[model samples]
Target: MRRFRHFTSSDSTSEINISPLIDVVFILLIFFIVTTVFVDEAGVEVNKPRAASSEDLEKNAILIAVTANGRVYQGGRNIGVGGVRSVIAALLEGDEEMPVIIQGDADANHGTIVKVIDAAKIAGAKSVSLATVK
Candidate 1:
């Protein structure tokens, strides 16, 4: 009687298996896609002053409106000068580098516009700009 020996091959590989990593990445992508909140502007109608050289501004900016009556508004809601700082501070909590645009009525008081600018700066905004009509 002859004894037969069985031969087996071994997998001695040092490379990492990346299939699980790829799956995790895909799952994260899907989670972000589903859980991300998109902010859309919904506010009072502003009668923006018209300007011949007004350029188109980038959307999704922090708008601070100064009405002709010296009233301040943020996101279309009435916010007085004292409240401006707090509102801007709240908005900047997520992004301190957020841009602020002051949309003052052409007939609005210059002093009011200045106050808005000052409040925006105090709120830690990187850039504070005026909004002009085009």
Candidate 2:
């Protein structure tokens, strides 16, 4: 006499699918990046004078800086007095109504500031505002 035996086993493992989670994370990243508002900086720091009647200006305007040594700067580069007109004009090519804001140091020469203003005006700036600390 002879005997034979046969056995069969079945086991299944399940895993958590993270594809949806990854997709959601990517969507959130894109949403934050699209909603972020970037601001333009003047690239130079000046000792802005205090003003009693200073008002808040728009964040999307062009910024120019004049150092205490009467040197003109735009975006951290020394553009000089003669370069103001050309730079401003180039910036205002498409947006003629954009306002120009000047940040003059507390000890900056008044004449240099005036010249900057004049150049900005000639460059077709709709409005020019002085930056001051409140």
Candidate 3:
């Protein structure tokens, strides 16, 4: 006589797949890169006044540059003194709290800087500051 035996065994394993998570991360990275805002540089040449303890200011500002020749510039474009009021008014029309920064050349006339400040104030700017290099 022969005896037969039957045996059964079960194997269990657990693992986590992270490939989908990695794909989602990459997609988010691409989306942010495409929608990110880039700040444009002010192309005008300005010889900023130097200060002993000048600090960096917020980049979200309206820059009004006064060259040594007494020319006024808004974002590097020549906007004459007569246009200063209008330009500043237009810029502050939507955001009255926008800050106005005057970048005056070291050799620029003091009166010109004063005029710029006055125009900015009349244009409804909440704050006005001078730009200086340290």
Off by over 4 Å in 1: 1-42, 51-53
Please estimate how well model 1 matches the true structure, expressed as its whole-model Cα lDDT: 0.79
> If the candidates were sorted by their lDDT against the true structure, best first, what order would they fall in?
2, 3, 1
Please list the C-alpha lDDT of all candidates, in the order they appear.
0.79, 0.91, 0.84
Off by over 4 Å in 3: 1-37
Q: Give the Å shift of residue 6 in candidate 1.
A: 49
What's the best-to-worst order under TM-score?
2, 3, 1
- Model 1 per-residue lDDT tens digits across residues 1-134: 99999876686657999999999999999999998766434154456777777666554578787888888887768888888889888988987777888878788888888988998898788888777766
Worst 10 residues of 1 by lDDT: 38-47
As a TM-score, model 2 comes out at 0.81
Q: Of the pair 2 and 3, which is ahead by lDDT? A: 2
TM-score of 3: 0.71
Cα error, candidate 1, residue 5 (Å): 54
Candidate 3 residue 15 Cα shift, in angstroms, is 19
Output the number of the lDDT-best candidate.
2
Q: lDDT for model 2, please.
A: 0.91
- Between candidates 2 and 3, the one scoring higher on TM-score is 2
Q: Which candidate's TM-score is highest?
A: 2
* Residue lDDT tens for model 3, 46-128: 88888888777655778888989999988778888888889889988877877888888899999999998998888788889
